[model samples]
Target: MATFWIVIIAIVALLLGTVLGFFLARKYMLTYLKKNPPINEQMLRTMMMQMGQKPSQKKINQMMRSMNNQFDKK
Candidate 1:
């Protein structure tokens, strides 16, 4: 019975630790990304140009909005 309790306690501790770590990591990433988003208009424009497509302001704005929506979803 003592060993069983010990095992249960260990499992609970492990799960709690995992949940705490996940939240901490997520918070850190959110701050980091807010400071430095994964993509920028300049990069997107350059990418479009590289792909032989014209990078218009409307297109760039649309892409930026989509990128922001993706981040918000996560």
Candidate 2:
């Protein structure tokens, strides 16, 4: 009976640790990504140039703002 109770307690602790770890990892990634976005103005400009569009400063700023707004909405 003591062994059975120990097993149950161990299983419960393992599950709780797994749940806590998942949320902590998720929160860390979200904050990291927010601080260091995968895309930046230079990359966006290069992409536009490759697509045959001459990227202007105004256009780049507009695109950046729109992208940030989209992320904010999420």
Candidate 3:
């Protein structure tokens, strides 16, 4: 009986720890991404230029808005 109770407690603790760790890691990644986005206007411009396209302001703004909307959708 004691061993069964011990097993149950251990399982519960393991589940709790897993949930806590997942949330903490998620929060950290969100904060990190906010501080350092994967892409920005300058980077986008550079990429476009490298692809042999002129980076126009209007195009840049439109791309940025679409990218932002993509993230917002998630």
lDDT of 1 by residue, 1-74 (tens): 99999999999999999999999999999989978997899999999999999999999999899989888898
For candidate 3, list the clashing residue pairs, or say none: none
Query: For model 3, where is the 10-residue window of minimal lDDT?
Result: 65-74
Looking at model 3, residue 35 earns an lDDT score of: 79
Residue ranges of candidate 2 with Cα displaced over 4 Å: none
Q: Could you tell me the TM-score of candidate 1?
A: 0.74
Off by more than 4 A, model 1:
1-7
Candidate 2: give the clashing pairs: none
Weakest lDDT window of 10 consecutive positions for candidate 1: 34-43
Each model's lDDT: 0.94, 0.96, 0.93
- RMSD of every prediction: 2.0, 1.1, 1.3
Clashes of each: 0, 0, 0
Better of 1 and 2 by lDDT: 2
lDDT score for candidate 3 against the true structure: 0.93
lDDT of 3 by residue, 3-71 (tens): 999999999999999999999999899788867879999999999999999999999999999988887
Any runs in candidate 3 off by more than 4 Å, and if so which?
A: none
TM-score of each: 0.74, 0.90, 0.85
